[model samples]
Target: MELIESYNSISESDLLIIEEKIGYQLPVEYKLFLLQHNGGRPVLDGVRYENEHFDFVGHFYAIRGEMYHDDLLRQIEEYKDMIPKGYLPIGESPGGDVFCISLKEPTEGALFHWDHEQANYDGEPWEYNMTKLSPSLTVFLEELCVGE
Candidate 1:
């Protein structure tokens, strides 16, 4: 994961605050990643999804930021109604698709892609939309290839 731009590493207190605000304990690996790289674009990034290469992961959002565009906490609140409850936005694709993690029990910490076009307002996010990207954020990063 070659970061194009990164923010300052956050302290443990910040992480705790975020967990409290989000109402769920973040996955250990993801919390560590955020501590190292608060937010940034990944260079030459591509991940395999259903046998197809998706190079659309443009940016990972910061926990909170002066720049409204990079504020993950705000983004999560903004998209709360649009996405299923307990799902939080962690990153975005170049085409504006959202990448999230399910906070619901039994499926907590699972990575998912929330496709706008395929969304169903009345149904659960995982029903006919929201593709599972990886079992965990750690695996997702590990599988992301630094493209040529």
Candidate 2:
């Protein structure tokens, strides 16, 4: 996927701090993407959720963007309990649902979507609450297509 508009690059030191604060090693492919384009829209529009498709990837949070909603670190903490354990918020649909990366064994680096309407923040993630977007971030980018 291509970044349409993005912020400046993040230094390795800053990235390290982010990792430390978040307690997970950032995916390498994602780190490369961040170094080139901290946050922005993918050229390919909407992403598919199960059989339903929505505005692909409207926006991603920058490592240190001025906007609260577009701030990566901020979103991480805000959505911490909203998402399953080890999942990191990376982007979102135009409707405000979240796209995240699985940080656990077996699904590490895989992309997932948390439906705002279906999720239960107080409970464990159920199949009804989550959809596997792609096996990996690379594959997710590859599957992206223009929105309606």
Maximum-lDDT candidate: 2
What number of clashing residue pairs does each candidate have, in the order they appear?
A: 0, 3
User: What tens-digit string does per-residue lDDT give for candidate 2 at 50-134?
Assistant: 6566546888878984366788999988887777777888988888888888888888889888888888756766547777789
Give the alpha carbon lDDT tens digit for every residue of 6-69 in model 1: 7777988998998898787877777888998997888757767886885478899886663578
TM-score of each: 0.86, 0.88
Error of 2 at 120 (Å): 0.7
**TM-score, predicted candidate 1 vs. hidden true structure:** 0.86
Q: Candidate 2 at residue 51, lDDT?
A: 54
